[model samples]
Target: MADLLDRRQRLAAALCLAAIDLPANAVAAGRQLMQAASVCPGVTMDEIPTNSRREALTKARDILNELISEASAP
Candidate 1:
């Protein structure tokens, strides 16, 4: 489960990187930072709710966040 969550987070970070046109190395660095800080979920969903060509990616981010957050609930 944790591995799956991590993969989803990485995918979200990749989307963000593409949206902002970050270089590949920087994208990996950003993904690592977010994963370490455990804020990957929010960071990933940051651009969601804004309709655009990247809407699919944004939605994926939002869905990933929803899943992780729900799982974290007691």
Candidate 2:
């Protein structure tokens, strides 16, 4: 339970970092998230924001959306 929560946090942090255009230790963070997720198979990527700070989560979402939008632009 606690481990699963930790992984969710790690994923949120990693995505937040990526969204902000910052270089992140994503491989390690992803490993933690994956391990935690494996233990709790029902987990979804959406859980990341649900388990983090509201302000941070909002920023992460906005940044991620922008990043995706930018990437998809031709």
Candidate 3:
């Protein structure tokens, strides 16, 4: 069960990186984010400025989606 959970977390991180179209040779910051996500599957931007936890999560998701779209554009 632990192995399965680990695999799922890794998969989630990989998917997030891929969605952002971040290559393996991406910047250090991007790599760091991927590494962090791999370990914390439920990562949130609560530490960031926001009125509420839900707002922070929504902001984070929107930012990620924007990055993905921008990266995917040719």
TM-score winner: 1
Off by over 4 Å in 1: 1-5, 20-53
User: Which candidate, 1 or 3, has the higher lDDT?
Assistant: 1
Q: lDDT of each prediction vs. the true structure?
A: 0.53, 0.52, 0.48
Q: Candidate 3 on 1-74: residue-level lDDT in tens?
A: 34544433343443444343223345764665556566656664443322343443454576666666876999
lDDT by residue for model 1 over 1-74, one digit each (tens)?
A: 34555656655554554443323467675564455336344544454322343664666678678778978999
Give the higher-lDDT candidate: 1 or 2: 1
What lDDT, from 0 to 1, does candidate 2 have? 0.52
Which 10-residue span in candidate 3 carries the lowest summed lDDT?
Answer: 15-24
Error of 1 at 16 (Å): 0.5
TM-score of each: 0.35, 0.34, 0.34
